[model samples]
Target: MPTPSEDGNASATAPTATKCDSEHTPQPQSVCEPDHRRSVVQNVVLIASVTLCMIVNTANLTGVSISLPTIGRDLHIVEDKLQWIMNAYSLSSGCLLLFFGRLADLYGRKRLFLCGCAWLGVFALGCGFAQNEITLDILRGIQGLGAAAAIPACLGILAHTFPPSTIRSIAFSTFAAGAPVGGALGNAVGGVLTQSTEKSWRSAFWFLAGMAAVCCVGGAFSIDKDEPYQLDDRRVDWLGAFLGTSGLILIVFALSDGSVAPDGWKTGYVIAILIIGVLIFALFVVWERYLERVQNGSGTRRRRWWTPPPLMNVSIWGRANGKLGVMLIIAFLQWCGFLSFSFWITLYYQNYAGLSPILTMVRLLPMNVTGFLCNVVVALVVGRVDLVILIVIGTTFTAVANLLFAVIDPAAPYWAFGFPATILAVFGADFVFAAGTLFVAKVCLPHEQSVGGALFNTLTQVGAAFGTAISTIVFNAGLTKASRKYGVEVHGSVANAPRPAQLVAYKDAMWAGFAFPLCGAILALLFLRGVGVVGHKTGPKVVDSDATTNEKTVSHPWPTLLLVYQAVEDR
Candidate 1:
């Protein structure tokens, strides 16, 4: 019932209303108490906690590769069954991201974040004691569900705590930095833990469990409980969530299990499941649309929208800038490039270069450092640059890196082919990740940010899952062909195989890995076109706006809620 006062401040029980661009000026009479210092500390803690979760989540994705030989040997895991270790986590985490994002908005970000940490820690501990591959795989899936819950909420919380353009840009930069940082750290930790004589690979799980426990304790104590608005207390779109989750599960299941299935791609079950997933996803969209319409009818103010309403906003999607849509596409494409390297590069280092897991991890440090630098620099420069041009340049460099990798051979020198490609790819990926994330942060109003961020991350994981699934198929098929043509025994350790045979299979698999980033480059380029047209910026040079729409749309002011926003304009 409260509205903005003459001076653009809100009294008790009312929300402050101001244009988003006017955030620099302090406005009194605001309902919410401002605590920039505590908010920053809490945000930092949130990052560390989420980074811990991400480390385990992504490490488990690739760590299984390093330990596959040992696991298979010790547990008698068959060739086909070993994949469940990775697939279980991918399917569970990727599918449930949107669900958790909405839950954070409905209940509380800190609450769900703590819950996810508990779930992840417990499941990680369970993995340490798992008796069989099947049990471990199931536990991995549970861990992924917890990660799915925590990650999006972490991002949403960051979105809320740092609503100002400059701070939001920095927060997103930190968030994006976590990916490459976590990825590199995961490999390093997995390598060290796997090398331990006392515990072997199980040590990795225990270490992760311990890390999650620390984060849980820190997060529970550090994060602030104050929120700008009251919980909407609306019903969760259970049917929509069900359909969407089932659809993704079916799709990923088809992708992951298809190659191992008896009939391969032609298998009836695979086809049926994929078809079902697609159909259900379509239904979910329609259901969400109906829900949106119903909510719009029930509320006069768009700010009073349903709790965690449909992940996508049609208004934003239809806008000329289409920043949200571009972000979705970038999430799909950028991750495609990143995940391809995550899945395939390890194989290249192992089979072709004959490096130990530890050696590979060390060799990858430069790229990770480069990525971190790029992330930091891009975050600093985001407010000054044109987004579309920045994305174009970065993605183009990524494509070039992928192309270089496609043609790499055993005789290729590390400095010439590998080093440059590593640098370019790392820089490109880091830049694109930061820019795309900024684009999303730029477009959203605060109330919708949690759900919006959840959607962005969901697509990111989905894309990575798809990219990994497709790349795995290509690598396996290519290896199979090279084995037959070169008369090499492909199964078992490549270390024991003939040099020529191993080299051929490794190079062929590397070549096949190009499919993902190449496709990513093209898709990202397509989406880059519309980035700055609708009152948005569009170039490589960083240019600050003079109190423009870019800042105006960054955050929403609510009179009924206590959210602080822009101050009154002189006009």
Candidate 2:
């Protein structure tokens, strides 16, 4: 059916329409999203709003590192407790992201995005005023929930608003650039504030809070009004949400906390928690599978008063010629190397070499420069370059970066070793992140954009946790062996240990860390090797939730704009 649209064009009435032509013959109202609903200036603002928010989000992360020492001193917190200040934020954010992402797709992305900003503003304000260690840690954890709520929705809004074009590519690349720049500012701003006045570390939180407020207002004014999902499609998968959130929290907490515990992996509670989390995740998988089957009418129905859809369908793994699932694993693996290099680079400058905070930040400045440059390059080369080649480059760079850091010379010139490592690490991250994000957006069902974004982000976060934990284990083992050989306390009370042994420990960890990206690179080479012409179905399948019959199809990719490297040919 064709309807008379406001633009005096025949628009398809069915939601099956994926393409639009505001400049020509388009399908439906979704096509009218950016050009028809928003002006060019508004589009620019929309991109800027998401970009600035990304900067603020990452700034909050690295900024905390700047103030941690001062915060420890002012609050009389022990050294081990400082990890919580950072980990709490990551834990909460990682655990809740998927749930919030699903909500964004179901309800409204714009609404969720705005609320997240305001909520973040409120709690970030509280974090600044917190007087005690426990209070601050709690506030930081709760504050993380804001990011979980907003990130998926924010990404969803972009995917929804933009048609597949160079503009969307630039938007994502610009957004990627913000992360490293924000990280640099986090250190710079927190350093500036902490150095300015006594007990001024708290000012960092206030700065972030104000930034959140600004992002919220800017996004509200700039982003287009969201088109709503169907009433029947707006069901919440409550049971799946509970299982997913709890399982993720437990798993991440165990992985992260295990490295820091006194007994490390041998700790009884940590082991138990890890097992429990793994089991819960398994259960979540089964539950989702069942729900999806039921949703498709393959199973008995009317089991409950309301049958909500699966928060994430288990069959998502089988989509996109199974490249989606394989890439998820590759992305996770590559990020391990990426996160480790970023983490160890700062530690190398500070803990290993005893550089001051400001000096350490200066040493890492190349990362910001490279990240910005990498994003620009990504925007230019992305549809033109084979995606697998870009991923291979990214993984190889990270592996090399980690290896360089592992063998870094204390007396080496910064340009010879440190600078290259910093630049390579950011380049790797930006390449993978930008490409991976765009791929997920393209493959996902239009309604599942937020959930897809959440899935990608969540994997990267978990990868970071594993990277940290695995590196810590290696570092600890190296220190223990050194202590045994030297017959001293090299493994314990690092300040009391031989400095050489501690340096060896850090090197050992970094050496082990490089293996992750090496694995990623190999996998990328083997599986996601090159661009191929996208396969198409003989006929389009109607989007039906309750359809029971599973007709095998030649291909199943959603027919969105070929925003990436896939070539389109006239049939």
Best candidate (score: lDDT): 2
Which parts of model 1 have CA positions greater than 4 angstroms off?
1-31, 34-69, 76-84, 156-176, 227-233, 298-308, 311-316, 321-323, 351-353, 444-447, 486-505, 524-527, 533-571
TM-score of every prediction relative to native: 0.79, 0.83
Alpha carbon deviation, residue 560, candidate 2 (Å): 9.4
- How do the residues 460-545 of candidate 2 rate in per-residue lDDT, one tens digit apiece? 86677667666766776787777666778542335555777877887887887799988987887887754331223222222112
- Candidate 2 versus the native: TM-score? 0.83
lDDT of 1 by residue, 71-147 (tens): 65567765434555766777688778778766665566778778887887888889888888778878888788888
Q: Rate the local accuracy (lDDT) of all candidates.
A: 0.60, 0.69
The residue pairs in collision within model 2 are: 21-26
Lowest lDDT 10-residue stretch of candidate 2: 551-560
Top candidate (TM-score): 2
